[model samples]
Target: VQAGQRLLIEGAAGNVGRKLIQLATAAGVTVVTTSSARDFDQCQRLGSQACYDYQSGFGDQLVRDEWTFDHVIDTSGRVALATNLDLLLLGGEVTLITAPKDDQFTFGVRAFYMAQKRINGFVISHATVDQLARAAEVLNQAFSAGQLLDDQVSQQHFSDAPRCHQWLEDGQDGHQRFVLLPD
Candidate 1:
C-alpha cells in the first residue's frame, strides 16, 4: 500500500480485514471498507475513512460517489468479487483470501482487459511454512506497535469452544472475537 493511495477492504470487521485497515492507515493509505452498519463505528475507530454496508451494494454506491480505488483486499469472496472488479481503477488489482463457494465466477472479459484489472487468490493452507512464519512476524510487530486491533476480546474456558463456534454460526457476535482459554 503506497502512501496516499486508496484501498478498499471487504469484510472489514473480520480479523484480516481489520488488520489491513490498521496497516494501511499507518502506511498513509486512504482506507475504505465494507462492513455491517452495526460495525461501522468500530471500523472507523480502526482508521477506515468510510464504512459501507456490504449488503447494500457498496461498490455501486462508491461508483456513484465517484470514488476509485488502487487496490482491494477481499476476505468475503463469494458475495464480493464481482462488485470488487467493478470498483477498480485502471491497472488496479484485487486480492482474495477465500474462494467463492460455487467454484464458478463470471465477468466481462472485455471490461477486464480494457481496465487492465487483475485478481489474485491466496490460500493460507497452501502457503509454505516460511511464508507463514513471515506473516506471523509481521502481524506480531503490528500488534506490538498498537497498529492491530485488540477490541472486544472475549474469553471462555476451553470447554466452551463448541458454544463459541455456535455463537459465530448464529452471528451473535458482530465484530467481536472469542478466545478459548486453556482448561
Candidate 2:
C-alpha cells in the first residue's frame, strides 16, 4: 500500500488483519478495520484509525461516515462480495484471502469495469518468487520496527498438534497463530 492511501481490513481481530494494520500504518496508509466490538481496543492498538463492528451494518456505517478505501484486505468472508464492490473507491481493489465456500458471487461487470474497481484472491504460497521477496523485505522491516504482532503467537506443545489443528479448522476460538513447541 502506498503512503496516504486508505485501506480497510475486515476481520481485524484475525492475525493477518492485525499484522496488516501494523504494516499499513507504518507505511503511512490510513487504515480502518471491522471486527467485533470486543476487539476494538486491540485493533486500535494495532494502529487502525477506526474500528466498526462487522455485525452491525458496518457497510452502511462506512457509507454514512463517507469512508472509502483504495484497498481492502478481507480475511473472513462475512462481508459479501457485492457490498465490498460498492465500498471501493475508484480504481480500488479488494483482496480476499478466504471466501464463502458454497456461495457464488456476482456483481455488475459493466459497473465494475467502468469504476475501475477490481477484486482478486490471494494465497501467499502461490506468489511468485519476486513477489515473495518483496513481501519478505516489508515483513522484515516491520519486524525490525517491532511492528510484528507477537501477541497473536501462542505457544503450544507438539502433543497438542491435533488440538491446534482442530481449533484452526473449527474457527471457534477466533484467530491466533500457533507456535508448536517440541514435545
Candidate 3:
C-alpha cells in the first residue's frame, strides 16, 4: 500500500483486521474499515481513518458517498464479494484471507476485465517459512514501535474454546480478543 492510497478492510475488529489497520497506517496508507458498532472505537484506536458499522449496511453508505478503494482486504469474507469489488477503483485489487463461509462468490466478468481488477486468495497456513519470517520481522518492528497492543488480548481457560468460537461467530465479543490458554 503506497502513501495516500485508500484501503478498505472488512472485519476490522477481528485479530487479523486490526493488524492490517496498524500495518497499513504505518505504511502511510489511508484506511477505511468496517466493523460492528460495538467495535467501532477499537477500529479507530487501531489507526483506521474511518470506521463504518457493517451491520448497518456500510456498503450502502459507500455507494451513496461514491467512495472507492485502491485495495480491499477481507478478513471475514462475510460481505457480498461483488459489493466489495464494485467499490474498487480501476486496477484495484481485492485480497481474501478467509474463504467465504458459503463457499460461493460471484462477480461481473465484463466489469472485472474492463477495470483490470485483481483478486487474490491468501492462505497464511500455506506461507513458506521465509515468508513467515519476513512477516514476523515486520510485526516485530510494529511491536517495537508500540503499534501492536498485546494488552487488549484476554486469556480464557482452554475448556472455553467452544464458547469462544461461538462468541466470535455470533459477534458477541467486540473490541476484546480472547486467547485460549491450554490447561
Candidate 4:
C-alpha cells in the first residue's frame, strides 16, 4: 500500500491484521477493518480509521457508508472473492494471506477482468531473501518505535505448544497473538 491510499483489512483484530494496521498506517495509508464488535476499539487504537463488526454484514455496511478501498488485505478466508471485488475501486486488488476454510470459491470472471482488478495469493515462504530482508528492516524500525505493542501478545514456553495450539484451534476467546519462547 502507498501513501494517501485506503486499505481494507478483514479480520483486523487478529495477529496479521493488527500488524498490517501498524505498518500500513505508519506508511501513511488509511486503514479500515472488519472484525468482531469487541475488537472495534482495539482496532481503532491500533490505527484503523474505521472498524466494522464482521458478524453484522460488514459488506453491506461499507456499501451503505459509500466506502471504497484502493486495496484489501484479507487475513481470514471468510469473505468471498466476488464480495471483495465489489468493494474495490477500479484497478484495485485483493490479496489473500490464508488458505480458505472452504475448498472452493467462485466469482464473476467477466467483472473481475473488466475492472482491471487483480487477486493474489500471499505466502511468506515464497518471498526471496532480499524481499524478506527489506520487510525485516521495516518491522525492526516499527518495533523500535514501539508501534508494535506487546499487550496483544501472549507468550508461552515452547513446551506448551500443544496446549496453545489446541486453545487456538478451539477458537480461544480473544484475538491476542501467540509467541512461543524457548523453554
Q: What TM-score goes with each of the models?
A: 0.88, 0.88, 0.86, 0.89
Writing each residue's lDDT as its tens digit, candidate 2 over 12-118 gives 88778888888888889999999999999989987999999999999999999999989988898878887888889889999899865538888888889999998
Residue 123 lDDT in candidate 3:
95
lDDT of 1 at 13: 88
**Residue-level lDDT tens digits of model 3 in 17-135:** 88889899989999999987877787888788788888888988987877799999989878888988999999999999988876777789899999999998899889999999999
Clashing pairs in 1: none
User: Worst lDDT window (10 residues) for model 3?
Assistant: 145-154
Model 2: ten consecutive residues of lowest lDDT? 144-153
Q: What is the lDDT of candidate 3?
A: 0.87
* Alpha carbon lDDT of each predicted model: 0.85, 0.88, 0.87, 0.88
> Measured by TM-score, how close is model 3 to the native structure?
0.86
lDDT preference between candidates 1 and 3, better one: 3
lDDT of 1 at 90: 92
The per-prediction tally of clashing pairs is 0, 0, 0, 0
Stretches of model 1 off by over 4 angstroms after superposition: none
Q: After superposition, how far is residue 170 of candidate 2 from its true place, in Å?
A: 6.5
Write candidate 1's Cα lDDT for 61-180 as tens digits: 899888789898888874646777888899988888887665777888899899999888889889999999988988888878876757788999999999999988998886668878
